[model samples]
Target: MTLTLAIVGRPNVGKSTLFNRLVGKRLALVDDQPGVTRDLREGEARLGDLRFTVIDTAGLEEATDESLEGRMRKLTERAVDMADVCLFIVDARTGLAPADRVFAEILRRRASHVILAANKAEGAAADAGVIEAWELGLGEPLRISAEHGEGMTDLYAALMPFADAAEAKTAETAPVTDVAVDEDGEAPALPGNDKPLQVAVVGRPNAGKSTLINKILGEDRLLTGPEAGITRDAISLQIDWAGTPMRIFDTAGMRKKAKVQEKLEKMSVSDGLRAVKFAEVVVVLLDAAIPFEQQDLRIADLAEREGRAVVVAINKWDLEDEKSVKLKALREAFEHLLPQLRGAPLVTVSAKTGRGLDRLQAAILKAHDVWNRRVSTARLNRWLTGMVEAHPPPAPQGKRIKLRYMTQAKTRPPGFVVMCSHPEKMPESYNRYLVNGLREAFDMPGTPIRLTLRSQSDKNPYKGRKKPGPSKLRKHLK
Candidate 1:
C-alpha cells in the first residue's frame, strides 16, 4: 500500500518548496510569484526511511465559482480529499493569515488526518509567527524551513505512525507465496520480453506537454497553466495504458539556444535533453496551430540523433479548423522538415479535451515496438546483397569497392555492421541510401537505424602481405 500526503496551504507558503524537498528533486517549479502552481503534481517522496506519494497543489483561495482561482481551489480540495494525510503549512515569517485560518478550518472539517507545519521557521523573526500558528487549533505545528533543509526529523517523526499503519495494512492483505516451490514453477524470462516502456514527451515552450501527460493519466498529475515554461524539471510517472505498463517523462519545453539565456532555463533544457537520451521512445509534441516551428524540427532531430524512436503528436487539434486541409499541410511540413522521421506516426490530439488520445497511445506502443525491433542475421545479409546489387558502392579511385558481409550488431535502435573494402572512403550519400533501404525493407519507419561500415582489411591479418613459396630454407633444401 502506498501512503499519500498532500501539502496544502495558502499561496506562497512554501508548499511546492516542501514538495521538492521531500521528493529530493526540483520537480515542482518554484518561484517568488504566488500561485505559480495551479494543478496537483504527485511524486514519490522519501523522508528518512519512509517512502510515500506526495502531492503539491495550488494555493487554497476563497473563490468557489467557475473562475480560474475557484477551479484551482476545487482541485486542491480534491487533493485534500484523496490524500491519506494533509500537511497543512503556514508561513512562519508572516504568521497565520485569515486565508490560512479558513483553509485550516476547511481541512479540520474535511480531512481525517492533518499535520500542521510552520514553514520558514529557521530565523528569529519567525518565532512570533510560529507561536501564532498554535492559534489555528490544529495541534503543535512542526517548525521547519523547506529551503534550508531544516526540521525534517520532526516531520519524519510526525509521519511515522501513518507510514507504519499503511505498512501494517499492506502486510496484512499481501498474498502469501510458498517458499519451497517446485523448480519448474517459475516462468522463464525471454529476450525482448514485457518490460515497462519509457516514453518521453518533449516539445517547445507551451506546446501542451504537461497537458498531454495529464490527459493521458486522466488526472491533474502535473501543473499546467497559461504561463509558458511552467515545467522546469523532467518529471517521470509510471502508468498503465491499455494493459501496457509505461513510464512517461514530461519534460520542459526547449527553446532555441539564443533564446535560452537564463541559467535556470539552461538547466531545464539540459534536464529535458537527458530525459530524451534515457527514454526508448520520444514523443515530439507540436502545437497544431503552429505545426512545425524551427525549434520543433530541432527537438525531433535531437531525438533522432539520440537514437530514440520518434513519434510526432500534433497537439490542440480541437482548436484547429478545416482539419483535413490542416492535417495535410502538417504532414507535408513534417515530411519536408524532418525527412529523418519520414514514416513515423503523426498523431493529432487535443490534450486539453482528451480527444484522439487512444490513437496517440497506440502510436506510442507501435513506436516502442519498432524501437526494440531486431532483424535476423540471415535476412539482413540477404537484404544487404540485394542493396549492393541494386546500387553498388561508389568507386572513388577507379576501383570498385567490394561489400563483403553484413550482420546485426545489436538492437534497441537496430544497429548493424557492414564489413566492406574501404569503410573510410564510403560516401555519406551511400550510407544514407543503405539506411533508407534498411528502413523501407524492414518496415522500420521513424525508429533510429544505425548502420556502421567497417573495413574488412582491418579484420584480416595478411591482407597486404605477399606469401613466400613456403619457408625459403625449406624450399632450398627440397
Candidate 2:
C-alpha cells in the first residue's frame, strides 16, 4: 500500500532534479540536456513528515504512434495512471509553452489528481512563470527550486492528504507481525539469528572505510588506529541500527599495484577482492576528497559482473559545504563513470557521524530484495510474450532461436535459466538484452542479473531406442 507519486513534464523541466530532491539521494540521472533520463525511475521519497514512493518519468513528446519517443511517452502515461497523484512540473524560468500545454491536456484528461509545480524558481526571474502556472488550472502553483531545495515544506503540505490516505490503507491491510513467534507466543531470540541485512563495506586504501565501520559499530571493533592496512582480516560483525539487524563486513583496504611494495598489503588487497565475492550487497566506500578513481569503477564493475547488489557510499561528507552541490556533481559523474552499472545506488554519507547510516542500510536492503526477487512463471511468461512482440529475436544461421520457457533457477543472486532450442548459438548480445529486460521488468537496478540459456533433454542416457553397446557385441564375438 505504498503511496506512489508520478512526476511528469516535458524534457529539462527539472523532473529529475525534483526527483532527486524528493528522494533525498542522487538516484536519478540529471543533466542539462533533454531526454537524458530514458526510463521511468522509481524510488522511496520523503518530504518533511511525508514518506511515499515516487516515479520520475521520461519527458513526454508527441511522436509517431510506434516510434521510440511515442513508446517513451506511453511509459510516462502508464506511470501517471498507476500513481496516486501526479506532480506536473514546468520550468518557471521559461514560463508555459505549447509543449507544456499539450502535456497538461493529456494529464488533465487522464490523471486523477494533479499537483502543479513551477520549478527553478529561485529569484525574481521566476516570478512571472509562477503566476503563469495558474493558467494550467490544476491549482495554485508551488514555486520550488528543486536544485536548491526551496519550497519543499509547502510541497509537503500539499502531499500530506495523499500520503496519509496511503499510510492508513497500509496499516489496515498489513499482516500481523511476529516473524519469530509461534502459536504459543513463546520464542527466544537466538544469538545472531535475527534476519540481519548482509552488507560488505569495500573500497581502496585510506578511503576511510575501516573508520566508517568503526563509527557504525559505535566502537573500535575494527581496530582503527589511522595506519593503513591495519585490518587484514575480513571480519563480520552483527549489529542493530535503529531496530534493523545488519551483518556488516569490514574488509582489508585495497591499493593500486604500483604503490603496493609490502607483501602484507598485497595479501590484504586479495582478501578484499574475495570479500566482494562473498557479499550479498556490497557498499563501495569512496573518499569524498577524490571520488570515483579508476579502481573504484573497476571494483564496482566486478561486483556487478559477479551479480552482487551494489550501493556506492561517498564517505567523508561531514567535511563538505553546500553538500547538495557536491552530491549533484558526483551523481552526474557516476552516470558516465560507471555506465556498466548504470542506475546503481549512489548514497552520500558521513560514516564518521552516521549521518546517512539508516538510509544507507535501507538502500542496501532494497538492493538485496531486488537481487533475490523471483517472478512467477505466469507473470514472467506474460512479460516475455510482450517483450518478444515489441522486439522479436533475430534469426541466427537461418534458424529462429526459440526461447521456449524461462524459470528462475535460484535466489541468492537471482539467476534465471531459460530452456531454448540452441543455447550455444544464442548471441551474447541477445543474452544481454534478456538480462536487461529482466532487470527493468523486475525493477532491479545496481544488481547483477544472471540469465543462463539451457537446453532441455531427457535425463536418462538411453531414453530413446538405444540397443546393446559395442562392448556387448565384442563380447559375443569373443
Candidate 3:
C-alpha cells in the first residue's frame, strides 16, 4: 500500500499550490479566491525519491451544520480520517489565525501522524509567523514555500521513513506466482484486478453537472449555486458505488465557441475538453427544460469524434411536468440531431431529487463495456461476408472493387482494418454502412467504431525480376 498524505489548512493557505507542485501537474485550480477547492482530490506525488498518494482537501471553516461551509468542513475532516499522515499547513506570511489553531487541535486529536508546515516562508518578513507556528505545539514547523519550491529537501526527509516502511511492508506480503494445479493438471487463471472506471460529466452552463456529481456522492462535495459558470475547473473524485470503484470528473460547463469570449472561460473550456479526452466514459448532461440544443448536439458530436463511450443524461427531470411527452420528444431529437451516436443510452435523472440515478449508473457501465468490446477475426470476417452479400460495393470508373478480408485491429473504441482491391474507390456511404452493421451485429451502441480501408494492390509490383541483365552486360564489357 502507498502512503497517503493529506494537506489540511484554513482557506487560501496555498494548500492547492503545494498539491499542484507535488503532483507535477496543474490539476487543481488556483486563484486568489478562497475556498476554491471544495472536495478532496488525490494524485500520485513524487518528491526526490519519496512516492506516495497526496490529497488536496477543502479548507476547514467554522459554520453552522446546515450551511455550505459546514458541509465543506465535513468533507475535509473525512480526508483527514483517510490519510495516513496529515500535513497541517499555516500561512507563514499572515501568522496563525484562530481557524488554523482550531483545525490544528482537530488534527492532533484525530490523526495518528501529523507534520507541521509553515508555508509562504520564502521571505524574511515571514520569520515571525513561522515562529508563531511553533506555538501550535506539534513539533518543529518546517518553514517552506510551496509556490517557490523551497525547503522541499527537509520535507522529503520528514516523509521518507514512512514511505520506506510502507514499501517494505508491501514487499513482505506480495502475491506469489506459484499455484496449485487443477484435476486436469492445468493451472487456473489468476483473478484480474479491475481498475477504477474513469467517467467525466460535462454539459452547458447551469445544466446541473456539479449537482449531479454531489448527488451521486451523497454529499455536497462539489460547490453548487444558482449562478452560471460557478465551476471554473475540472475536479475529480473517487467513489465506490454498489461495489465498483469509480473516478468521476466534474467539469466546467462548456458554451458555444462564439459565446466564449473571456480568457478565463476559454481556459475552463479547454480544461473540460482535456478531461473529456482523458475519460473513458463521458456523460453529456442536458437541461431537462431545454434539452438537445445546438450546443448540446455539438458537445455530443465532439465526444463521438474523440472516440469515447457516450451516455446522454437529461438532468433536472424533477422539474419537468410532461414526462411522457418530453421523453418522447427528447428521444426523437437525440436520434435526429446526433445520428453518429445512434443507439446510445439516453437516461433521465434529477440531480436535486436524486431520481433515476441507478439507471444512469447502469447506462454508464454498459457504455464502458461496449467501448472496450472486441470481435474475433473469424467472426469479423464472417460478418463482413454477410454485409458484402447484403449490399455490394459501388465500383467507381467501371472497375470492380473487392473487399478481400477484414479483421479487428484493436479495441477501446474498437478499430478494424479492411483489405480491399480498390480501397480508394470505396465511398463514404459504404463505410458508414459497414460501421453501422458492426455496431448492430456486435451489440455495440453509443461507442465509437473505427473502420480503416487498406488496398491489397499497395504491395510491390516487380518482385520476381532477375538481376542477370546487369551481370550479362558487365561480363560482355569485361
- Top candidate (lDDT): 3
- All candidates' lDDT scores? 0.89, 0.81, 0.90
144-235 per-residue lDDT for model 3 (tens digits):
99999998998999998888888888899999887799999998764322468889999999999999999999987787877788787788
Which of the two candidates, 1 or 2, achieves a greater lDDT against the reference? 1
Off by over 4 Å in 2: 1-195, 225-227, 456-478
Estimate the TM-score for candidate 3.
0.81
User: Native-vs-model 1 lDDT?
Assistant: 0.89
TM-score (all chains, Cα) for each model: 0.84, 0.55, 0.81
lDDT string for model 1 (1-478, tens) is 8889999999999999999999998778787867767767789899988999999989899999767788788889999999999999999999888998888899999997999999999979999999999999999999999999999999999999999998899999999985554488865554223567899999999999998998888887676788788777787888888778888999989999999987778877887998999999899999887878888889999999999999999999999879999989888988899998989999999998999999999998889888888889899889989999999889988977888889888888899999888788899999999999998998889888888988776456777887667687588888
Count of residue pairs whose backbone atoms collide, per candidate: 0, 0, 0
Q: After superposition, how far is residue 473 of candidate 3 from its true place, in Å?
A: 18
* Model 2 C-alpha lDDT per residue in residues 1-478, reported as the tens digit of each score: 8789999999989998888888887656566667755556677898876779898888888874756577667778888999999999999999998988888888999998999999999999999999998998888999999999999988988989888888899899999976777688868676435567777888887778767877887864444444555555465667786676777777777776788886556655766677778788999999899999988887788888877889999998999988888899999999888866767788888877889887787888788888888788888788878877887777888877777778888887788888877688887888778778887887878677678888865367767866879999899889
